[model samples]
Target: MKKVLIISSTRNSNLDLSKDIKNYLMDKDELETEVIALEDFELPLYTPTLEEQFKSTESFPKNISKIKDLICSSDVMIWCSPEYNGGISPIVTNTIAWISRATDDWKEGFKDKHCLICTSSGGNGKNFIKGFEMQLKYLGSNVFDRSLIKTKAKNIEEFEFTSVLTDFYKNIFSE
Candidate 1:
């Protein structure tokens, strides 16, 4: 069975959201699902200096390898995060930076993988969805066009959530 990796950037609402998604997708006989909260990992901010230091010492954070392996082993990824300043949250970006740097190929974890961007944010989350979609596509992911957006003013309806996930599942696994 293929694996579905749900990455949550926060431990609060976003983590709850990731769990919901995992529960929804868990029954699929062809796939196994797991949820990971980025907050659980201790990753330093990515900088050329820090990268050099890690490279020189050959001691990148242990969590980086764990995350990279999860991403690389999975066939699909569901990204759950909150918008920060009309963009991707720092944790999501930081995780990606570490993963990219830790891998032999920068896109090793993302290339040819299927990804669905989701958010539970204070705002509408359009910028986050669009911006992260572009970044994931650049890294060689097949990003789903539709997203699951739950904002403070508007929660995702049950039917809509199911529909989006159904469509995304078909998109990734269609024969």
Candidate 2:
């Protein structure tokens, strides 16, 4: 079975949303799913100085190293975050920063992988999806076009959720 890593970028609605996604994917027999909430990790801000320090120590922070292992082992990645300041939240970006820098084993960890971007934010979450989709594609991920987005007044309709997940699942497994 292929492994899928679902990342929740915040402890707020995004976490709840990620859990929902995990529950949905867990039922699939062809795939195994795991959820990681950023709130559960003890990660420091990534910086050039931090990278140098980690290089000297020959190790990343415990949680970041663990996350790196998960990301490298997984066959697919699902990101659930809020739109912060018309872009992705700092937690998501920071986690990616750490993952990208804190590794030599999987330097291009995301290359040719499949990524699905979803958001449960107060706003429409369009900017986040757009920005994150571009970033993931730049990392060589094949991103799904149909995203799951939830606004204050509008929860994801069943049809939209079903359609997106169905297409996303097909896309990941077919690749």
Candidate 3:
């Protein structure tokens, strides 16, 4: 079975959203799903000084390397994040920054891999979703167009979001 890694880039209530996505994906027998909360991998803020240190040492921080490996190993990636200040949360960007620097071939970790971006936020999640897709595509991921968004009004009921996510997975698997 293909392995799918779902990355939740928020803490607290957003964790519930990520769990919902995991449970929905689990319903499918075709793919084995794992959920990784960004909070679990607490990385230091990236800096040029740190980059120089890692390069000179010829090794990345253990957590950063581990996350890069996880991203490379997975067949597909699902990102559930929140919008902060009209953009992706810092945690999400931080992880990406670390992963991009940790490897010789940054794009290799992401290139052509199936990717889906979703968000649960105060308002409609369009800004985060759109911003994230731009970055993901730039990194060479084959991003899916239909993204799942849960706004304050809807807030992602279990059944509706799950059904949409399941259908999205089915379509991706079919293709």
The 0-to-1 C-alpha lDDT of every candidate, in the order given, reads: 0.91, 0.86, 0.84
Model 2 worst lDDT window (10 residues): 102-111
TM-score of 1: 0.97
Give Cα distance to truth, residue 166, candidate 2, Å: 1.1
Alpha-carbon runs more than 4 Å astray in model 2: 105-107
TM-scores of the candidates in the order shown: 0.97, 0.94, 0.91
Task: Provide the global lDDT of candidate 2 against the true structure.
Answer: 0.86
Candidate with top lDDT is 1
Report per-prediction Cα RMSD to one decimal: 0.9, 1.4, 1.7
For model 1, how does the per-residue alpha-carbon lDDT over 72-161 read when each residue is reduced to its tens digit?
A: 999999999999999999988998988888888999899998899999999889999999999999999999999999999989999999
For 1-175, candidate 2 gives per-residue lDDT tens digits of 8889988988888888888888888887799999888878968988999889888988767888888888888889899998999998888888889888867733467888888999998889999999999999987888888899999879999888888888899888784
- Error at 90, model 3, angstroms: 1.3
Q: Which 10-residue window in model 3 sums to the lowest lDDT?
A: 155-164
The TM-score measured for candidate 2 stands at 0.94
List the pairs of residues colliding in candidate 3: none
